[model samples]
Target: MDAKLAQIREDREELEHLLSLAQRARVKDMLSINLRKLDTEYIVTKEKLDQAQVAVTLGQASVTNTPVGRQLDANPVIKAYDTTIKTYSWDQSDKFVKVFLTGLGDLSQVSPDQIVQQFTQHSVSIRINQVGDRNLLFNIHHTGQPIDPKQSYVKVKSDMISIYLAKIERGRQWPHLRASDEVTQKPIAPPKIDETADPSAGLMSMMKQMYEEGDDEMKQTIAKAWSEGQSKNSPF
Candidate 1:
């Protein structure tokens, strides 16, 4: 899974790069041609990379921490299983969420590059590879690990891998969503999903809700975010 995620990371980046080329086409014909190339490659490459990595790491240890050193000191398959067991994994609980956020199932019909573009207008767009999406889905469903409310479209978005990267970073930097806010002088409460509506619309609503209901002092605190959509910014 991790490997596939890495390749998807690569593929997503590459397709996005190509999409930029396509988007830059001045002529309508060129636009269509470039767009087609980008969309098609994104679909095919993303799937291929995702599947390829999954094939290797599925149901196994991706990285071998202590393969023959401690766990299998005298095992016959020591050499055979010496490889690391650290790879991306798809848990039964998060399988659906994984495909959903990665823009694999329903959103797959749309061009990933375009979808990513809708959020920020940065020179280079970003994508959420499967691994990070996997983690985000886990947090969403199991741990109530609130995704950043600032990521307004996260509800129906395919920008997970990157999203999790932010979540991880926030956790590392702040220890909790309760970020420091000099204005309110308090940490914000984590966000929780209330309903399952149109994923994108639901997300937008969720963000507005947070902003409206949050303590006035904390509103500014939570406003700081990683941005998605077309503005030359990385996925938040």
Candidate 2:
């Protein structure tokens, strides 16, 4: 999955370069279409990888018990001890979003391996094992904005657990910490493409829709690429 993602990213860069340099309308549109497809594939692949890793980690956690030589508890009453950590503060800088989980009771003393955390693009789950009488859990199913799972990390502080979420796009401020905190309207879906018709037309329509829905930086990128394609002569 990692190798596939790397290939997709490399192909995207090449296509983007061709799109910027191509003078002919047909060639530019074709490059644009493939670039969009690559972007979609990369996102889907990365998400699957994240989920798979999380599942493996959870499985490992469940199977690990006392050493083989140690005696086991006879008919151990497995009391469900999952305490939801609700008291948290969040702050963001240009590059990272910081989440501080409070009331975890001196996490600095706990072993790093005892803290189980999983990160996805839009969510985070942190489980602090053997914390007092119960396991402390801090979970967000959906964040206010997307984060880079690969670069994000956690730090155990003296009084709390600090989560540093690397922003996918730098300098984009989050409106709220969680998606549920704000009343957000559902995003409009792109118009369905008709395969029977000219494929370039469908590609152009999709590109226009993306430009409309994207952020300021995204809009600038598309506009610049289009402008460059129009002005430059095709090297090929």
Candidate 3:
């Protein structure tokens, strides 16, 4: 997964550079060609990356649920570390809450410090200990007084592999926290594109639309393709 992500990053960087050069040279034709190719590649790559991430997260969850996994999580050494770190979270009402987050994709990529930085607004501290390859034990600490767990909530950002403390109804499971509404409602499949209508023209139109409306990453991909085109001396 890491290798694939690295390669994708390299590809994206090259495309971005090409797009920059195309714009600078004012080569409208080359720019248009690169935009279409980049848009197509970006859509495919993004889908692959998303699927890979989901696989990693699901694999982690599976491993973490095993008997040995449970034992590792419950280890006294881990408990001691959690106590030593003094990490915590508080709700909007300023009530203390305990948060356990797991099933994260690319756990090795995210550091405990990064987690703390992400929750600076809540003034929450965090301690993350890797129980094994697939599980991370989080100890969250809040400066405020303890409150009812019922009034507290867990906000899971599936895309970011982040878990934030929230104020909502209780009864939601921990470690296997549910995804946010936005994530759940997001489309699982890409939009359909016509393939039979003058393939090149149809693709160009679709790519143009996607480029204009796509997110930052998609735009970066279009840019990268232009860069790649310039480097290879290819129109596409």
Model 2: residues with Cα > 4 Å off, grouped in runs: 1-80, 184-236
List model 3 lDDT by residue over 1-236, tens digit each. Answer: 44543543454344334433332222323333443344445445555765666666555655777876566456423211121222332223222234434334545454444332223222233334442332333422221222344333334344233334543333443321211111323343333456444434554565566567656665666657756556798655
- Compose the digit string of candidate 1's lDDT tens values, residues 1-236: 34433543443343344333321112112222323333443455455755665555532443555564444334322111111112232221221112123333343333333333122222212332333222111121111122333332433333322222223124233222211111233333334444334333443554466557755432443343212233445453
- TM-score winner among the candidates? 2
What TM-score quantifies how close candidate 2 is to the native fold? 0.46
TM-score of each: 0.22, 0.46, 0.23
The segments of candidate 3 whose C-alpha lies over 4 angstroms from its true place after superposition are 1-26, 63-236
> What lDDT does each candidate get?
0.32, 0.67, 0.40
Query: Per TM-score, what order, best first?
Result: 2, 3, 1
Task: Assess candidate 2 and give its lDDT.
Answer: 0.67
Worst 10 residues of 2 by lDDT: 68-77
lDDT of residue 31 for candidate 2 = 44
Q: What is the lDDT of residue 35 in candidate 1?
A: 30
Output the worst ten-in-a-row residue range by lDDT, candidate 3. 77-86
